[model samples]
Target: MTSLLKQPVVDAINGQVVEEFTASLQYTAIALYFDSETLPQLSGFFHLQAQEEHMHAMKLLNYITEAGGQPIVPATKPVKNHFESVEEAVALALNQELKVTEQINSLVSVAVRENDYLTQQFLQWFVTEQLEEVSSMSDLLNIVRRAGKDLFRIEDWLVQNPHEAAAGGAA
Candidate 1:
């Protein structure tokens, strides 16, 4: 396999690292908003998402270093706007996950074009992660859509379906 640390591939990988960290920051902000608004279950869900994003960032950072590339320290941007409702929050989460999935695919395309097999291998994990993320977000959206205006019903739905939360960690 060609060394991915060389030139363009290194830059691409570093960019992905930054994006992963940014995703973590965004999800953490959503989590905090849920916590402040007294939605513990939603807060817990986003908190776990934030943790997962951080783990993804670290994984990419480590890969960059292992490939002899300098892992750039990521800068954090403020996440603005609190979600007005569960539906809005879940929709935002789904959109954000979709965005990340696109980013990962783009990166993988770059690696493939550059013939960087090692980078492709490294990105395989992220591809799987994005699949799980999109699926989870979609599932949440479906649940909230079904729950509609009944917040109590939504809470009950969550309580009855504990496996949904468990599946998030499975990714």
Candidate 2:
């Protein structure tokens, strides 16, 4: 199939696929951390996050294929497996979300520069998605910080706020 996306845009999306998969692995690491700590709610939250990130990667891959571009499923970069504190882990997640927001914005810029309306429209979902991702991670970080030594509070918050447990994906 002839590629609908220019080379630059295709390259950018492939890079984003790596980022998304890396995020999934990072979240899985965090979930393992929480599980070891015996915080089921927190662990479950990150497990859900990991699945969402994997889905995000798959979405980009599908978009690339549908656009007639050869989708490259590159290996993800290494992720931090250990974290000192709950706040530290949550902070890391928020930071990752922020970085991904920048990446998605860059993708949009590339589409705009190339005048690829189709690619630009296709990426709008991710553009809007970043807003929710960043916001949810930020909120989780705040809660973790405020809970301080009371880590159970964070778990309780996750329980009380079920939608938040799903990382803003729930209705």
lDDT of each: 0.79, 0.91
Best candidate, TM-score-wise? 2
Clashes in candidate 2: how many?
0
lDDT of 2 by residue, 66-160 (tens): 98999999988999998998888989999999999999999999999999999888888888888888988899888888898998899899999
Q: What range of 10 consecutive residues in model 2 has the weakest lDDT sum?
A: 162-171
Report the lDDT of model 2 for residue 118: 92
- TM-scores, all models, native as reference: 0.90, 0.97
lDDT of 1 by residue, 43-133 (tens): 7778888888888888888887777777887786556557778788788888888988898899999888888888898799888878878
Model 2 TM-score, 2 decimals: 0.97
The collision pairs in model 1 are none
